[model samples]
Target: MNGIEAPNRLAELRQAAALTQQEVAERVGVPVSAGQVSRWERGEQAPSLRYRHRLAAVFGVGVADLGIPSAPLPRQRSSAEDWFVSDEQDPRVTKSQDEWRRTRALLNQNRHSLSQVAADLYPEHRLAGTGLIAGGGWIPEQPVDLARIELSEVPDAPEPVLSGGEREAARMLPDQTLTRSYDRYTRAVRDLAPPRLFEDRVSWRLLDVDWSAGAGRMSFGDTTYFNAVDVFEPCAHELAYVALDADGGLAAHPHMRDLPYRKLIGSPFDFARRPVMPAISTLTIRRGAGDDVSFLLHRRDPRAVAAAGGMLQVIPSGIFQPSSLMPAGRAADFDLWRNIQREFSEELLGMPECDGHGRPVDYTSGPFAVLDQARADGRLTVHCLGVALDALTLVGEILTVLVVDAPVFDSLAADFVERNDEGTVVAERFPFTEGGVRGLLDSGSVAPAGAGCLELAWRWRDVLL
Candidate 1:
């Protein structure tokens, strides 16, 4: 194991310390960003023990706490498929146990040499695990004797993956995941000691736009009864990312608190430049049925338990699907939105809505939308910051104008305009179906913004009411 990522433990540290990226950087005397913190939590990056010591110092914790030894070594490696958590047996995490022993021995012996290596690798950098420059567990103050030390890079397992394990685990995996398994973990998360010091910031920007033609409005007649309002502003270019657990509650992982307060909860941010998404990504695993999540392991190694520590799987069923009806050109429409946003404005709308997870259609571009040439006067502009499960990263947010009823649309075809000048939206009566989303009753009037988005509620509940 050359690189077993410990997202869970890393997240625990950040959460326990309650330090923001800038705070962590300053405490450790290094320059770091929230993005760097995210990479650490995502298993995309790693900090040497020296840096880890610095992190420990900043958090007022011991270096050993930062190390949650549960990984394979050089002689042994487990792919995502090889690991599994079985009810019939305890996970064979002995490999992690052995590695920790080796690491401890090496650290005690060659602390100075390793610190020198780390300092060379990161000049002006302090230890992360110890959060110290030189002292007990510190490099210079208590250098590990180079003569007796058998130093080497800590061996780690390959990143766990669903690999082909998803297939085999399916055989033994349960259909519905019980929340009980996550309970003790949740308690551990809640008990993390708070950080001693932290500096934080929140940044936001507006996404300017140009209104255009052929743009229409959507309204809910029941919106009047329920007091639907323009809950969010559309000026921000950032989005918030929220993870959900198997039991349908928010993921609310502890490490997120370390993000800049503005982006603390994946809230939102404003940006001037356009955000680009991956051109193409192949889904290693497709959607599964309820509780079918049992088979969802990386190499059947049970190490996923550790990975899931700070991260979320973004299981297909866990996503929030706003709209049930599937249209053929939704993918095409999203492509157009991306094209227009990238080519014209940085807005991410002008297309159908998307569930936070995988697209109903194969990946085309992204979960972007816009507020450009697609708006009119009566349109209510709402700004929002959100995050995508598959793509990762917060959107800071984008502006979306909900034109209750465009005058042009009414003029072009009164029947098509759901919300008209009369504060009423004509319904496309599905005389045959009892409860169908056909038309609005009187949804043109704006209500006050509530704690949660009334607009989102109106859009979804309109179908039933």
Candidate 2:
């Protein structure tokens, strides 16, 4: 065994045995403190081999039963210490670590300037006021009718073809980069538990987008979450570092020179060379008659999430995925509105996450049913403003807006939470005025996709309001 499964039921077992932390510590026959035992139970720390064996014996169970590996714990490197253990001591690991550090520093220093580079790269897709790029003609000027947007799943979607240079660059990438990146994330956010890298979790990969006949059509295929983390995330980091470098830019960056796929940064619509998994980002608004319009924003906790940490984003943003792994669940969740509803439940209502391993969700009843009825009665309106790729990450975003009548919003507001799994919601709603919206766009802390959605929503105020 290597790393132990997360969130061990040590507390449960201790209670079942009718023992306190101090009692358990004494039974271990070592200098263990109650505090140390508490850490072990909470998964904040792991026990040594001797402690593991002693604790298992004290609990009257095998090491494996206590969520402790039977094998000796591997020696940890301080620089790359993480919950997930890596036994390799290769030079490539050190190189990857150095590269990650450099990239992280560059991003921190040049965070505000990223939008300029994005506009320069994809001038055609860049929105007029914001630094976001909309593909497939899903621009704010031409709002997509919710009825015309179509999403179809393609189980046998062909894999994207990589050019010779892209393949070579991929080969040159260090195997330990991804692990080391996750380690860095864990270290930065020590208070929050690290996220499990579910490599097998199915995600909807955008195969293609078409808008030739005045209707929006998007085709999707299934891809693993780890695939995006492995390929796109690092690529985005390296590209950002290279593009923002003042010394020599792309020509001078050592890693950028090897990564020919960096050229694809400008081509937002070319899904042939890489996978593009979009997150559904909705700008939720509460509106009444004249002057009674307010929007919600989320301040993402830097210590909680790996991406877009400490940034302002539209409320209720999440990846486009099914609630359950069943085929029926996937078919039922293929709608844009369903994905948004799930996000609203999780991010707004503080509901438990639907992580795609449970039973299929029944959309005919519960809160989902209430939302459906509201939409049917014209008390709720949902519209797709467009789809945009982030300037820094190149991660796709399905930009949308949800407008609910003041009465409906007030009823739901009773259950609204101040914080969720991702971060804190700005408790006070901001008025949907031109000045307020422009201030947020200029704040420099807003995520590109969020800014784009806000801009589009403001543009369509006449219709949306």
lDDT of each: 0.25, 0.68
Give the TM-score (vs. native) of candidate 2: 0.73
Q: How many clashes in each candidate?
A: 83, 0
TM-score of every candidate relative to the true structure: 0.18, 0.73
State the lDDT at 99 in candidate 2: 50
Runs with alpha carbons beyond 4 Å of true place in candidate 1: 1-207, 210-395, 399-465
Question: Tens digit of lDDT per residue, candidate 2, span 1-465?
Answer: 148555676787788877799977665533567877897787666675435545654554544578744343444422212333553335555445445444544553444455546555666667764666666555535666677888888888887653223553353243344354332232321211222222246889987776655568888997766555555555555556556654324433333344455564336677766668888999999997789899999998643465666788999899888889898998898889999988898888887888998988878976788888999999998888877777555677888999999998888888999988778999989889999899998877787778888988888888888
Against the true structure, candidate 1 has what lDDT? 0.25
Worst 10 residues of 2 by lDDT: 188-197
lDDT of 1 by residue, 1-465 (tens): 249656546677766655566656554543445565565566555554334444554554554666633331222212221233321212232222223223322222232232223223222433222111211211121111112222121123222121112232122111122321212211111112112221111111112221213122111110110010001100010111212232323344323232222122222222212221111100011112332111110111111111111111111111111111244433233332222222111111123323222334433333222123223232312222111111122221111112212332233233222221111221321121112211111121111111011222224222212
Identify the leading candidate in terms of TM-score: 2
Which residue pairs show collisions in model 2? none
Best by lDDT: 2
